[model samples]
Target: MNNLRIVVRGGGDLATGVIHRLWRAGFTPLVLECASPAAIRRQVALCEAVYAGSATVEGMTGVLIHSLSEAVAVWQADQVPVLVDETAACVNILQPEIVIDAIIAKKNLGTHIDMAPLTIALGPGFTAGMDVHAVVETKRGHNLGRVILEGSAAPNSGIPGVIAGFGKERVLHAPAAGVLHVVQDIGSVVQKGQLIAEITTADGSVVPVEATLTGIIRGMIRDGFPVTEGFKIADIDPRQEELANCFTISDKARCIAGSVLELVCAYANKA
Candidate 1:
């Protein structure tokens, strides 16, 4: 087991995939996140620790920590620690050996190549050799997890990956701006045209958020969270036979996680 100090920014679903692999590989990874994370797949996201104090995904536990002391304690206990630091201010204090920006915000949020001895970023908005040491492909395709050493990943296509031949139809968006009220939660089997949620608009009138396709509720934002018109709020997986997939890391995420782990190991071995 490796005991390298790695600081990861973001605890969302995709970030959690990387964090999970790193922890399982013996690396002590500390996650940096915003005070309130907007993770839709709460079941598989380490950011859920922000609200529940701790969250378990596929047998890996992530604990919410505040200070350096708690971070070390969590590390010693073999649990990943999630810190609420959007700017990653703790990087200056912790001085970790490796830093990874897994925010998946589709744009750079202040991450730099000099943040650590070896810095890596996932997805677009980052140049491999300029903004960070390396960039991992996040767009679902033949190059999904390919590592880029000197260039940026593919640009965002403004579309979700196709699942079971259903692309945009698998994603749910808010029809109006308002507070969300969930009727069907994650992992629930939903049919097309079914009411899964409702949005309470400015006038207090509720608007129904229906399922666009018949499938399992793979993801859904927390109830009461404010959403804007056309904002992504849920996801439906057309494959109804794989219910456990809702709670497990996705194939795309695992592919990307493997690439991140490979890069970290490459650098660690060099040191």
Candidate 2:
């Protein structure tokens, strides 16, 4: 077997707790987090691997996407320790055989995920330095597992996609070619059918571009640069009311339709 290796996700005090447990037991760790490197510098040396991107652990059947993706890299160590994170509104978007819901509110945020009959694993409330018992329900019956909380809970996270207009505005550009099709400028109020920017070939070729939606211009292509086809011309804010509910974090719901991905793998072994 390889040396003990644990890949934990989260950048809070809760995460630190889990890290501490592993270290106290003489196991190294890897952290898959999105916070700034300087913020978690102390833990950096202790981690054998780090994925500074979002660690999405949607409940998948028999396969955790993020864990599986990092398997090769983390496995390089001795034994693949564990990758785990806690979520209030945990979801099994990947269809995990087990779904865990520890959300505080049971109203709209009910823990009952859409898909059932898999397995449900949950700790009443997971907190730093807290030890708890979890009930695991399978097709046949329930099993018991021990749960210990460490480090910070988790960042109230969200991810939002921007809707942009069609234009040469706010788009990163090539130091190459293109011409304006219409009066397109940064921070302009554009309509759905508005004409944005256009390009002409050196040999008398002309191209026409149209606006994609109605919104305020948010970005621009770099100044004095030529743009190639399919380049980002601008950024726009959608006029839809949904924008009001848009969340820019990850752990939280961007909308009611969204789900939180939390994957944890913890196995007790000897040092």
Candidate 3:
């Protein structure tokens, strides 16, 4: 399609990557760089607009944010159908139709999700300018439910067990006695063996615990944050699975996908 306008925050390599993509996708990319006039001039020729300040929600006039928040807020236009995570860390912002946190895999910033929905892209490293990787498969669009985190195996134990994701999976009780140091909180993405808490033995021994597979942090036992032997930890997002470099949209549609979700999606990297 044509007439698509995207404003990318940050003028570094990441912004350039997204910009090139938007162009290929038929969208005009506007760069919002905090660099000097000369530094941006080279990129400006290919952009629709260039703002040289803190990208804010105010006066924001694009579909994305790569520079300032004020401009991003303004540009936070549209129903915000989806959030494509090209950023590095877990960004705690407003909300969108969907949030694709596809960067360097870390703790899931549960705060970044709002009513719409959350879906984590499953793949290798989470970084900038990668491809949108497709994790599991129930169907094409049907798989766009919960946000999946990094993990392998059958996906069972975690702060919240993997079973909890499907609302049917069962959670095995804690083995010994201890306080829940870091029980998986709702919204946190977890790995198969990631540290979820610190279980203390009756003998006064503290042991950091881990999960059994990859999934999103679904629920917790208490808010006080206890790390006990039998304390309930969290539920993992069941979306974790082996992902490839490309996925077919339908029976006759196909495109490229990335590990963390960096793609020429908006513009598929120009000529």
Best by lDDT: 1
Per-residue lDDT of candidate 1, residues 112-222 (tens digit): 999999999999999988999999999998999999999999999889999899998998999999999999999999999999999999999999999999999999999
Could you tell me every candidate's TM-score relative to the true structure? 0.98, 0.26, 0.25
Residue-by-residue lDDT tens digits, candidate 2, 84-182: 333322234333333333222111123333333321223232332322222211111121122223422222222123333323332333222564333
Task: Sort the predicted structures by TM-score, highest score first.
Answer: 1, 2, 3
Clash count for each candidate, listed in order shown: 0, 41, 56
RMSD of each: 0.9, 16.5, 16.4
lDDT of 2: 0.34
Q: What local lDDT score does residue 39 receive in model 1, on the 0 to 100 scale?
A: 91
Query: Would you list the C-alpha lDDT of every candidate in the order shown?
Result: 0.93, 0.34, 0.34
- Model 3 regions more than 4 Å off: 1-172, 223-231, 240-271
Put the candidates in lDDT order, highest first. Answer: 1, 3, 2
Candidate 3 global TM-score? 0.25
